[model samples]
Target chain A: MTGVLTVVGLGPGDARWLTPAASEALASATDLVGYGPYVDRVPGTPGQGRHSSDNRVEVDRARFALDLAARGARVAVVSGGDPGVFAMAAAVFEAVENGDPAWRNLDIRVEPGITAMLAAAARVGAPLGGDFCVMSLSDNLKPWEVVEARLRAAVAADFVVALYNPISSARPWQLGAAFKIVSEIRAPDTPVILARAVGRPDERIRTEPLSQVEAASADMSTIVIIGASTTRLIGRAEGEAPYVYTPRFYGVRP
Target chain B: MTGVLTVVGLGPGDARWLTPAASEALASATDLVGYGPYVDRVPGTPGQGRHSSDNRVEVDRARFALDLAARGARVAVVSGGDPGVFAMAAAVFEAVENGDPAWRNLDIRVEPGITAMLAAAARVGAPLGGDFCVMSLSDNLKPWEVVEARLRAAVAADFVVALYNPISSARPWQLGAAFKIVSEIRAPDTPVILARAVGRPDERIRTEPLSQVEAASADMSTIVIIGASTTRLIGRAEGEAPYVYTPRFYGVRP
Candidate 1:
């Protein structure tokens, strides 16, 4: 039996945000593999073996999934948010490209899901309504200079910036550096969103101006969004959360 | 009776890709409003009234949805893909911001879904497997010069660029101009993906080198992806579709 390997996104932390396609892939898999937290999110199924590993072991986990599929076990490699965005889909492809040549013949597919940025955007009323750039703040994969340069370019182009992996225990100062770079170029009144554990019960979304935003507010579970020049706030009645959005209209200059 | 206005995403063209949160919003809606094509995508309910409109009337459609909800109708404003990204969520928020203050008091929520780029990226391997930028080529909202400058900035930053609204019937040359701007800075071998009608029955995905990519190949339904400098093609055995991906590991030159 030629078993299939599927990479599926679980979507932020909400079960309701999970796509039916990804749900079906997980339900039908004989084995599931992913980071421990993501694997824990999947509903338990009878006869399905779960292989959960620690964070930062994406390639190893992907290789394990590929090996399971090669040995005739239907496997699903899962990730939080869309698998294709800084997640398991790329790692699976990398394993296939560099690992055993026979892994190429195995059926592999990526099932998309609602990414964290989209989920955060929805919760906060479309801060990413215009052109945007998504970048990882962690310099583990790339140089810090690349991150700084990309942030500068995004700001110069006036794109709303969605930052993932903004701050971690090991890389606590990167978010501050990023903020310093962006705050220098953007207006003081430009909106910045710090969304933590989006879609989860403990989800916290804070929207502040570029001048007042504190980089120390972000953590590993947080995703930060820096609004473009066009981003604005809709005033709320007393005690209500204000609606934040970047208008679709541009160039006319409000 | 206070009613709710929920803006939901239909997720590319596949019903299976729709999130449960969005599906629930649709099922509970007494009225639906969107562009004709997207409104048609929602499953018709016996009691649900569908209000379809022409394109480019986003604000008008949003107003209609808000009005329906204000008068005690549970209205769902739908968009293709995640409403937060270049879609209906911003329009809805704009209406609420500029419209009656009473509209602010009504219950409003955004239900996120799988955006087109994620769906297209999943279908074509992980072309956006790293840091990327998303921009729309339509000059309807922003200036052509802004688009050109943004494209140049994205190329300079070496971002995998995803171009939405690549070509419309009225704006056929924008994609070509975008292509010209990027090709001038990037390597000739960089990959360019034209994903048309992604997740639909008539979907077509073509991967070509930046040098050979024709801007005329794209249409309103297409989302074009330009790979970063680090993107690579995985060699496939005969008769197999090529796998394109950007590795998770960066800074180490290929």
Candidate 2:
């Protein structure tokens, strides 16, 4: 009996941010596999077996899910944020490419979710309103040089950059390093956004100019949005957070 | 009485992709305002009034919403995808910046949705599995030169590029011109995907080598994804669509 492997995203932290397609996929799965926290986000479905693993074991978790599907056990692999963006979707595909060839034919589907960048951007206003790039700042899988190069290229090209996995225990200085790099290319007045745990009870989104933003305030739950030269901050009444957005039009003045 | 202005995204043409957050925002709104087609996506609430305007008049539409909200109407300004990304969120902010200053004090909120690129990327495997950039090919507001420069910079940076608004009736040549620039920088074997009306009834996602992809097949509703250098295609059972993904590991091999 050929089974199915469905990859779904839980969307930032809230169940309310979950899409109907993702919710349906979760409801239909016989087994759920994901990182412990992400898997726990899904309410228990009767008769559904859940296998939770550590965050570092993405490929292993994906292969395990694939194996379960190969044995005719329907499996759903869950990820926080969009499964396809720095999440389970890529790992699942990586497993399919390298694992047992028969796993290819097992029906696999990926349902997109509201990624952290989009949710974070929404909460803070539209910093990603125009041309933008999303980059993972973690150098765990890739070389540090590669991350810096991509960051420089993205900032130099004037793409509003949304950085994920900015800071962790193992790599603590990357966020500061990213800020320093961006600050050099951008003016001191360029806006920097720190949106942490957006869509969750602990959500905090603040915008500051490049000269004033503190990299230390960011943690793993943070999404760092560095605006383009054209990004603007709209004023608000006293004691209210300002709205930030990058205008749609690109004015190339001589 | 101060009223609320909620900017929400309906996702990419499907009710299933809409987030509960966006849905709740719509449900609580007393008035809905947006581009005509986007405004129509929200199922009519018994007493909620809708103000549909042409797509070209984004600022005008935003000002209208703000005006309604100023008069104590809970207004939701809807967009097709995530409102924060190239949608009503920016337009609303733009209007707030230029219109009556009182609009700034209004309680404005943005609810995220599944954008076209993410939805399209998921339908295929994770083509945007790693660092990626999104750019609109429309030159209506921005000059054609700015578009070309951005296209070149994005391609040269090896960011998997997602092209939105690829071809409109008025801007037929931009998509083709974009392909020519991307081909010059990327390998001929690089994968090109055309995802049209991704979640809607007319959904079609096809992948082709950069060398052979026809520019004319794409229309305004299409999102064109060009693979990064690291993007790989997994072998699939004959007659099955291949899974495309950019691996998490960036082997910037020396």
Individual DockQ of the candidates? 0.75, 0.69
Writing each residue's lDDT as its tens digit, candidate 2 over B149-198 gives: 87788888788999988998898888889999998999998999999998
Q: In candidate 1, which residue ranges exceed 4 Å CA deviation?
A: none
A1-254: candidate 2 lDDT, tens digit per residue: 47999999899998999999999999999999999999889997999999999988899999999999999988999999999899999999989998999988889999999999998898878889889988999998888887888888888878899999999988888889989999889999999999999878898888889999988899999998999999998888789888899988888521
Docking model 2 quality class: medium
Q: Where does model 2 exceed 4 Å of error?
A: A252-254, B252-254
TM-score of chain B of 2: 0.97
User: Candidate 2 chain B — worst ten consecutive residues by lDDT sum?
Assistant: B245-254
Measured with C-alpha atoms, the lDDT of residue B102 in candidate 2 is: 88
TM-score of chain B of each: 0.97, 0.97
Extract clashing residue pairs from model 1: none
